[model samples]
Target chain A: MTNNILYSIKDLSKSFSQSNKKVTALRNVTLDINRGDFISIQGPTGGGKSTLLQMLGGLEKPTSGMISLDQDDLEKLGEAKLTNVRAKKVGFIFQNYNLIPTLTALENVQIALVPLGIKKLESERRALAALESVALSDRANHFPSELSGGQQQRVAIARALVKNPEVILADEPTGNLDEETRDQIIDLLVNLNKESGITIMLVTHDSNVAKRANKNLHISNGVVTTRS
Target chain B: MFFTYLRREISKRKRQTLLVSVALGTSIGLIIVVNAASAGIGDAQKTVLSGLYGIGTDISVTKSIQPTQGGRGFNFGPENADSSGASTLNQTRLTVPIFSGTFDGQTLKQIKSTKGVSRIAATLKLNQIIFKGSIAGTASNPTTPQDPNARPRGFGGGNFNIDMTSIEGVDTSLTNVGPLSGVNIDKGRIFQASDANSQNVLADSTYALAQKIDVGSTVSVGSGTFTVVGIVSSASSSPETSANLYIPLAQAQTLSSNPDLVTNIYVAADSSSNTDSVQKAIEALLPDSTVSSQADLAKNLSGSLSSASSLVNALSKWLSIFVLLVAFLIAILFTSSGVTRRIREFGTLKAIGWKTNRIVRQIMGESLVTSFFGAIIGLAIGVVGIFVVNTIAPTLSASVVSPGRFGGAAPGGPGGPGVPGFQPPAGGFTGRGTGFGRAAENATTLKLHIGMNVSTLILGVLIAILGGLIAGAYGSWKASRLSPAVALRSVA
Candidate 1:
């Protein structure tokens, strides 16, 4: 591991009991990603790709593992500090484009910056800049319903980028878009990754989408095999 | 930033927010009005008491006796005898023996020198023999001729009427006679020290009316001719007794044709002095006569009225509590439901690294804002209700709602529009029946006295805020416990 390692996971495991039987989502997974790495995680459905992503994002604590971001242990930080780390260091883009309905595109992005204790006017400026980065600056004042599916996805990406986090995680960000919109979003995300030098970790089932990443890790039966 | 979140949340759920605010406002407004009305009743009671007795007296004493067919004899045994009579009493009577002995100058000097004794004024109780006209001649009187048209009368062989009278001799030094002293003189001048020699007297209005006499008219009582100098009104004196002529005590004594006989002794003591000591000293000096204090009389009167008023006040207070409690509970339930519906939104914020405390603060802030508006609306309604009630029943003495009455206005100015400078009648508290009757006539006036004070308003808002906080905190806590993976998957 180099000093540029942004996140490392070792022996990370998570299981759920269904009807008195254990179902393991992830088992003994070991992975490390350096800064500015754009990695795509590909696996069959229910193959623990989402679970592995959640643990890496510090949104979920692993059952047994040593997970560290930079030099800080994810399990050792208290709830408040954990929240701070998540807000300042990681940005997530979801498949549903979970934009707050009541807020406009700008406000949705601004929500990510609220936990950072930024002032309203400054947060709005930064959020607008982030929206422009995704070429949706004209839709900054539109609500999620007013925008098209592709435009909403762009807004979600803008919300993620507004925080300027070290890593950006996308859990099926383009899963709901049509093929053309999906290709457009992949181009936008890749361009963002290259321009900002932000680490990108995405879980995708589309073969064409997976090929755009700098690296691919294929997962099966709770195991990951890195492919150069 | 917190306010922004609060404002956004409230505006986002406009309908729910309105429902909660309206419910809370109406409840609080009603409480203010009801409380004001109740307080008015309490004030009325105090006024009635103070008017009937002096402020120094908080209790009353009256003789308790069982009803008996025959006349009861006096018991002159021990000084502290337990009369052991039934609680039902026809009336209380203070009896003093009449002694017709020349008080040698030395005896008068001795009385003046007595300890614990204040100044005393002598009084003469006179019984009048009234005759309508000349009596008809009886058969036993041979020289007396009877008119054939005149019917023979039963008993004493004449149309005779008996009238009871008492001459209260007030000394110039002995002023301040409780309710009697409070009598408003309608006309003429009160009895002055010099008037004692001029045969001038202050007569009760009722007595003057019955006698068909006005001020400056001379009326004969016993052997004295008294010119009415003033007419006075009194609520305490009975209708029958108020008809008697009030002559100077010295004149009554002289007119009795026996200046040495004094029926009763009236004394005035310093209001701040220990009445018990003064009473004991008087008892020692006037061993043959009975001594009584005004405090003993007031206590007996106050005790009876208070017992009944207490029960009514307690019932009204409890009713107010019940209404407020139900209102608060409804508010809590509504707030809880509102918070539950917004759980997903809270979870989103939590997942985005917003602290649980921040979420809680947002919820509380929303509730506080809503309740603040509700309280304002409620106060407006209460004030309007009070004004309407006051208008319909002006006699209810809507003074209770006046500023500075009943703990001042309700935070703002709920008491302003009624009657300016109006004060609830001095004797406001009457029996429940009386109080209700007045309230029915003018509820606004009644409520003005009972309206909520600043403290009550603050307490109400605090309770509302607490409800909001609890609901919000519960929602946030539930959101926090969710695994981000599960939440995100659920969204998908």
Candidate 2:
């Protein structure tokens, strides 16, 4: 109930239909994400870590139970409202960087502010500022294919920062990066979290990154167990 | 943001864009080319009609040959007697009598007085004896061909030639109007008012050239020795109407012994738009005459040639549909494939708070750009196709038959191209053609006029754009429906 709590998950569950078979991706997942908390959801492949992050970001609806983001029930909200919630309150960082292949790094960053209906000039200014913060101001004009993996991830971080959302939902944010690039990207997310007081929910298979989080939630077969 | 992304994506996939555009463009181009040819054929039809009816002349009025039912021996009425028959006109039928189906002064005055009537020219068409190797200008009797194998004026009349040829005696003043007026004078000047009473005549260029006659030459036609004052190039005149000699109407009426008469009257309406009204007025005044407009002339010229026109029209219509469908399908398929390839890209966009409509709009923008390029390429292909048609087959002649007409076509020479070899039909519309040796008319040489007009060009471009957008919209809507979760989960 406190103003610091970003999300409260209770009896959260999700299932998917795979070729006529019911696949339970998550079950009875409960967790609390405090404001500015750097939380990592660690699990193996198909262990529902990504689904949990999707639920937290209001990108996907839970089939059962409740997900309250910023004190509003995500499942109770309409599609457009949930989308707006995602737009105004949550930003995503994907493993593949998920930069629109066509857009340059700066345009990709500008995209985050597009749904907010900000003026073009202001959007571009904010986008550039975000790129500068990610230390890729020089690579702002480079397309995704034009930049190295580390640089693309950094650009992706700038895109997330452009919206200045309260929650950054990172889904295996460093999954496809080399070791050094991964560490650098992890540092960037952690820095964003520590410096901006931005709530960070990181999904990864690496226990090491999870261990670095303020709170680590481990998932095995749809169950979440917190690690001290 | 959407547009910026669209621009970047389209340019980034320039090769794909070009390939897709070319595919759609070629289809659109084919449609343009086919329609242009069809348009050319339509123009050719109009040209032949204009030439026959007189350039700018809209309606042609000629007295019908139908004979009145009751006629005693040696007594004749227009409805009961043939011009070639041995009969004399009675007092009551004096306006249109025997031995001459030509209109009289009263009928001419009536026609000229009609509303919307601008100008009228009356011509008395006749057949006179051909004076071969002899300058005998007497209508007393027929002359023998001194050289029978001498090339009969532009026909397959080899050796077995007809003893008589056509002569048109037109009003000297009215020669500035009518079918005889618009033709080009290849040599010398047309008939002057002074020449109406004087001994002067105009000759068809085809006949003059074949006969080796020119201006200042004297030739004996009928019983008159007249100086050939001009050589005329005629596109409309079949050998039947392309009179070997053009004399004063008065002189021709005298020679034919049907004074103050004419067989056909050409009427020029004030404007093309008034032709129908003028034609109706002429028909009302001269109730017994057959009044035909330029449209009627073209319609009556239907034959195997019109079959070709019909084929081209049908082909253009169906091919247009085919090309449009193909264009739509290509855009749809291309957009769908593109969406599939960029699934994650779209997912990212959706995850980035882009509304479904926004994504759809970007897809449409890309599709439109691709189609715009296609339209340009298609127009180019169309123009090139038209040029090729003009070069490959500049002039095409297809024989046509009209009512009450069979003609012999004048041979093509240096006078002009695309002149239909006019041969009179084998038989007139009415079985009476056998009564007077009517010549068979050959087809008019049709020159293709294929060019893109602004309206058609605009319409074609519009179709291409609409087609591309419609298909793109469909594909985009499908893309919009793609759940970001589903797309992100799918590796491919």
Candidate 3:
């Protein structure tokens, strides 16, 4: 994989107003992630890890500082263009595995390709391939309810991968899974990153999970410290 | 792609969507049905009233006399003559004859030539005794014989027997008084100008039949027995109480015991003629008698039917508003609940890069499809309901249901032969086969002059689409505003 910087964040800060009081979530933090790098963000609860990820994913704008992806400043893009960028370039995996309960595992993956205006048959084929990549091909027809917690999270990961985006942002990918299932999910994500050379930024508090990344980012008191 | 999203969204919230659609369809359908029925009945009533009373007659007049002056009161007799023996004695006495002076033929000619007199007709009213019992006397009364020529006394004073009359008149063009004088001959014939000097007379069918008299049979009126040349139906002048015996003016005068007096006079004018001028001319010609046109007479006879029709329209409008409100509330509730239940699914779509606008379009499309189906179902229900109501409740005519004529046929009773019926061919609640049937039938030949217009259909469709759009837009906006992080957190 190329050793080119894909995301560069500098002096990023964010604060929210709650009950007429200002509560800072993230304070001056700087980071750089290269293409194909798998980085894990580790911090205690309320450590601003999720807030930092949201800002980098363009899901929320930083209160201050600059976030650039592939030399394109995200702050400069209009709302519509920002949304378009997120749709085309970023894939998100939530902690809850947010697989739409009404859809099957394959359909959850198929949804990612819909925004690309792919034909139904091709989209389904791509979704099937994504499910197969996660080793859930046999369970493609099962709905989220029919799958275990680990299986649902795997389906969510497949949905994220089907988009072929430039960055994969996962917020506590195995936060709700048992240790055994969590280990399995981490292994699958690590192998995916190694094989596809896809850049992954994951938020996790587990040391074992963090150890799987090529680089570790620690956030404390709104400051991010990168340790190789 | 958007439609696929819509299908998914609907499937996700099937119950909520269905509830909203059903509520909207029912409300809108109810409004449509009520409005259609009210409009239909209003038009029918207008046609019936117009047919019964010509156009633009603002007033009506009848003989008014002081009850204490011993003057003859206005005749308010039943539509059919007395069929029982005790009713004739109760008939109000006519002490002041309709006409008391000598019958002057020169005066009739003079009245004919007067200006402002569009058309004039002279009428006579009298009571003639008729034999109603069987020709053969009952076993208890051997004195009476079974013979057509047998003369019986005191028959006119009995309830089962009474004096019937033949009113005669020439075809005079009176200003706006055509309905009062325009006798619709349903079966046989009408009095002609040629019959003026002849002995032929046209009697009311109901009266003739009740009196056991047939056409071509000779019946005595005054001093003469005239052959029943024709049978005329009753005019719609008084729906409940009008039994007219029509004959030529001259024949009527000759048959009356008092030949010089005429019962009443009616004047009809051309559409362009001023009613006031005709009234003035008649007043000047006959200073001692009353002079009034059809308009003046109608005002005194019955209240305006238009006011009643307006009341019905107002009621229908209120009903429509109520239905619309109900539909709006239902849509709001169902859409809100639907959006709430689908939060997590929406977040997933958002994560997969679905724009808010695309999501909105999908919701709207689903709502529109559901609303369209519901509207169709509601329309079907309304049409069938109206047909069933109309069929079962024959008393509720296509015309305004007047409180006074609740149990009987309407005045003018389904427009006589050659006259159109009250229900117009084009107006009424039309849907399913009803509207199309009417269109197909009316295409070949014109029957009822009124019909359904494009505005009705357009209005219904527009309201339905508007409902769908509103529901869909509301659902979409709600879903779009959801926080993907919070939604994902909530998903178990």
Name the candidate that leads on lDDT. Answer: 2
Off by over 4 Å in 1: A17-23, A218-221, A225-228, B47-51, B54-57, B62-159, B162-177, B180-185, B188-208, B211-319, B394-490
DockQ of each: 0.49, 0.56, 0.32
Worst lDDT window (10 residues) for model 3 chain B?
B437-446
lDDT per residue (tens digit) for residues A1-228 in model 3? 334999988988888887999888888877788989899999887778888887777767788999988777887776677677778888888888878776789988888887788999999999999999999999998988899999999998998899888889999998899999999999998998898888999999888899999999988767788887
Tell me, per candidate, how large a share of the native contacts it keeps. Answer: 0.47, 0.64, 0.49
Task: For model 3, state the Cα shift of residue B154 in Å.
Answer: 27
Arranged by DockQ, best first = 2, 1, 3
lDDT-superior candidate, 1 or 2: 2
Q: Is candidate 1 or candidate 3 better by DockQ?
A: 1
TM-score of 1: 0.67
| B152-251 per-residue lDDT for model 3 (tens digits) | 3322222233233424343322323433343456555555546657666566565666666667877554555567776654243322112235445555
lDDT of each residue in B1-492, candidate 2, tens digit only: 767877897899998798778877887778887787787777777666655556767787765454333331111122332333221222211112222356788988988899898989888877553212211111221122344444323321111122444677887876656757667777798777777777788887766766788999997655668898888876553332345678888888876678877887888888878889899877778787778886777666664446657878898999888877877787788788888988998888888788888888888888988889888987787778777877886655655444433222321112111111223333312121221233234356655668776666777788778867887888798897899877877741
Better of 2 and 3 by lDDT: 2
lDDT of 1: 0.61
How do the residues A1-228 of candidate 2 rate in per-residue lDDT, one tens digit apiece?
Answer: 488888888999999898999999899887778999998888777888888888887778999999999888998998788778878888988888888888889999998898899999999999999999989999889888999988998898898889989899988888888888888888888888889999998988886677778988888889899887
| CAPRI docking class of candidate 3 | acceptable
lDDT, candidate 1, A1-228, per-residue tens: 478999888887887787999988888888888999999999999898888888877877877878899888986777778888888888888887887777788888888998999999999899999999999999888888899999999998998899899898998988999999999999998998899899999999998999999999988888888987
Model 3 segments beyond 4 Å from truth? Answer: A1-3, B32-51, B54-185, B189-203, B210-315, B387-391, B394-464, B482-492
